[model samples]
Target: MTAITINFNNVVKLNVDQFYQLCRDNPDVKFERNQLGEIIIMPPTGGETGKCNASMIADFVIWNRQTKLAEVFDSSTCFKLPNGSDRSPDVSWIKLERWNVLKPEQREKFPPIAPDFVLELMSSSDSLSETQAKMQEYVNAGVKLGWLIDRKTRRVEIYRQGQPKEILEFPTSLCGEDILPGFVLDLQIIWN
Candidate 1:
């Protein structure tokens, strides 16, 4: 279940449109791009991971419905990062303004903008090093806040731009802070 990275290094890499087409061609698979132009092929999550992911997405969706300040995206939505990587966070939020500025075509395709907030739920199959690096990449691409939720360890790694990562051990809940005003994620269910 380990994700594999195929480096195109020096050889011609697929452009954004080409990558989108590649994804279209392979309807059953998930694909991602790294800043280095390497392709990351991710396998589907197992049942447990899928259920947990669904719970997390549900929380975000409910909060977004109340606030209407941002748009909520699920894992299936990929973004073209400023650093040139195409990433799909487990759950992501983009400020309404940022999303509004994109052309209709851009909106239809992968939007070329970093999310304001992102969450990475660590499935048992994901490698810690690779996932952590991906979170940092989100910060570099101008994400205001990010969370790496490790259900296995019952810990959360908080990523904020221009700051070091903060780890919370056995946190019962996490407040969205200014990034997601008035929103709070209760972690008790996931911890169990």
Candidate 2:
């Protein structure tokens, strides 16, 4: 689907408060705002996508429960990036210390902190270029690590700060490295 950008030339651009209110008014819609002041309205994920997304995040959830080194967030949690964009990565994690630096109000609202790690699942409706750009944005906003997984191609693009993206084809499992210490994502976990 082609995304529509709100034309600010003829229309008044929404301030952050207005944008937040607009989101609150539309409970059923998923929304995102880029640094360019463009609003992205995303269609709800299909059942298959939702299932796969759940599977993709299960490992992180369990690991966070055990180690509690970081807080894990599902797709529904929105974060305010340092660049002033509101984004929701499919699966996100923030180190415990970083997460606690926010005031209670900040934690309750869209927290103004970039995640340390982010994972994005490419749905059929998603634009691959857009997804890749979003990953780059995460890196630019200080995300230490990010992954863009394309199940159809069975390819994974790993993003690391100050490093070019590393692409892997048909990997068996993913190593979390020092960022996640001892956590591994098994490729086989994705249901057929």
Cα distance off (Å), candidate 1, residue 14? 0.7
Per residue, candidate 2 scores C-alpha lDDT tens digits across 6-84 of 6462577887778788888998888888988788887777787788889878889998899989999999888889998
| Model 1 regions lying over 4 Å from their true place | none
For every model shown, the clashing-pair count is 0, 0
The lDDT of model 1 is 0.93
TM value for model 1: 0.98
Candidate 1 lDDT over 1-192, as tens digits, reads: 889888876786798999999988998989999998899999889887888889989999998998899899999999999999999999999999989999999999989999999999888899999999999999999999999999899989999989999999999999999999998999986887
**Top-TM-score candidate index:** 1
Q: In model 1, where is the ten-residue run with the lowest total lDDT?
A: 4-13
